[model samples]
Structures are given as C-alpha cells and as structure tokens.
Target: MRLFAWAALAACICAAPTLAAPQISALGTPAAPTAAASDPQAAAAVRVAMRQETLPPGGSLPEHRQSGERYLYVVAGRLKVSNLVTGEEQVVEAGKMAAEQPGDWHVAVALGAQAATFYVIDRGPADGAATTAANNDGN
Candidate 1:
C-alpha cells in the first residue's frame, strides 16, 4: 500500500504543469506610421509604442538610438543607463523613471545580482524601429 501511495505521489508531481518564465512583450500597433509624416508642412500625429523587457543581471543593451522620444520605468531591480554621446550616466531604481530624447545614443545595463524588468514607452514615427544600433566609434 505504501509503495502504491509513493508511486501515486511521484506521478502527480511529474504531471504538474511547469510555470512559464517571464519575458519581454510588445503589444499593439503604432498610432501613426513614419510614412504618415511624409508631408513636411503637414502636422503629423506622433506614433506611440510600448514594451516590457527583462534584462538578466550584468546583461546590457548596447549603444543605440531611437528616432523618437522614449520613457523608461524600472519595474524591478536596478537599471544603469549611460549616454554614449555625452558620457552621462544615471541609475534608475524600481519605481523610478527616465526619459530619452530622439537621436540620443545610450546603453542600459542590469545592476547587481538580480535581473531587472522595465517598461518602455516610445513616441516617434509609427513604423520606426524601437532602437537602432549606433556606431561604436565614439561618434
């Protein structure tokens, strides 16, 4: 009877579903596409994009730039952001936020032992990439 009970417990444990790990997710479409701003004289509506990302400890997003404005909010852990152009650095902690200007080159890294999770809201051309890699030559 005891052997049967142990086997049943093992089977139940093995059959349990595994939890999925959290990951970055980008949702929805941009409100205005870059092409929509083709007319220089026309007032174009800005596009908005939102995404959530998780950076492993010591991991980093390389030097990059966005075509529009970006706002970052740290959800968990700590984030170290550096401006490649100006050589300025800022540490954003959980519950804190930071802003990035259009065409600004910057890099973000996860600080400390724990991974960091953050949300990004970007406003720019509707169809533009969230970020573009910048030339590494201190340019």
Candidate 2:
C-alpha cells in the first residue's frame, strides 16, 4: 500500500503543469530627438557613461552646465527642467526623456510628492569633466 501511494504521489506531481519562463518584450522605439549635437564629428569622439540618479521631492539641481551632451530618462516621478539659455521649461514625467546639449545651462527640480528617479547618459570627451558651473551672471 505504501509503495502504491508513493507511486500515485509521484504520478500526480509529474502530471502537474509547470510554470512558464518569464516573457521578454520590447519597451518601445525612441521618440523624436530632444537634443542633438551641434557637431556630429565632435560628438563621435566622446566617451559614453550611464548612471542612475534620484532626487527627493522639492530637490533641485542649481543652474549648471554639462561638459557634454546629457540624456535623462525619467524612471519615476517627475522633473521640471528649465533652460536658462532659451527661456524654455518643461516637465519630464515618468517613462519620458529629456536631453541637454553640451554647455546648455539648465536647472532641474523634482516635482510632486515623490522622489524622482532617472537614468542619465552622458557623452563627453574622453578626458572632459562631467559637469561645470554655469555662469549665472545672465550669460
């Protein structure tokens, strides 16, 4: 009887359905260009770096400039980016991207009550600094 019971249990277990492997799907295609290099040749010579950044609610990055082009993709929450040069401003929401050209002075502020998380891709000269303070003297 024990042997029969053991066999029955094994058979039941073997007949059970197995779980499927996780699915893989593409997120989506890239959107229209938000920013572009002024010179393609110069952009091609830069090094690429990627990092994840987070800013708490109400936090802000003071007016500054990047040494190279910057692509910021918002993963969560929202960010308000103000272009000091063009007097343009926009709110970047989750799953959206924002780009800043080299030497474009801008300030970013975290909006809403949640912390904003994003992925930053920087393309700059191999030996160039990542960022620099912008001339706030109405330049």
lDDT of 2 by residue, 48-83 (tens): 666677899999877878765566678889998877
Q: Candidate 1 lDDT, tens digit per residue, 10-126?
A: 432232233221111211122233332344322233355566789999999767787665667788899998766667688989877676655767789999999999876665444
Worst 10 residues of 1 by lDDT: 20-29
Candidate RMSDs in Å, in order, are 16.0, 17.6
Q: Model 2: how far is 27 from its true place, Å? A: 24
The TM-scores of all predictions, comma-separated, are: 0.62, 0.61
Candidate 1 wrongly placed segments (more than 4 Å): 1-44, 127-139
- Candidate 1: give the clashing pairs: 32-126
Candidate 2 global lDDT: 0.62
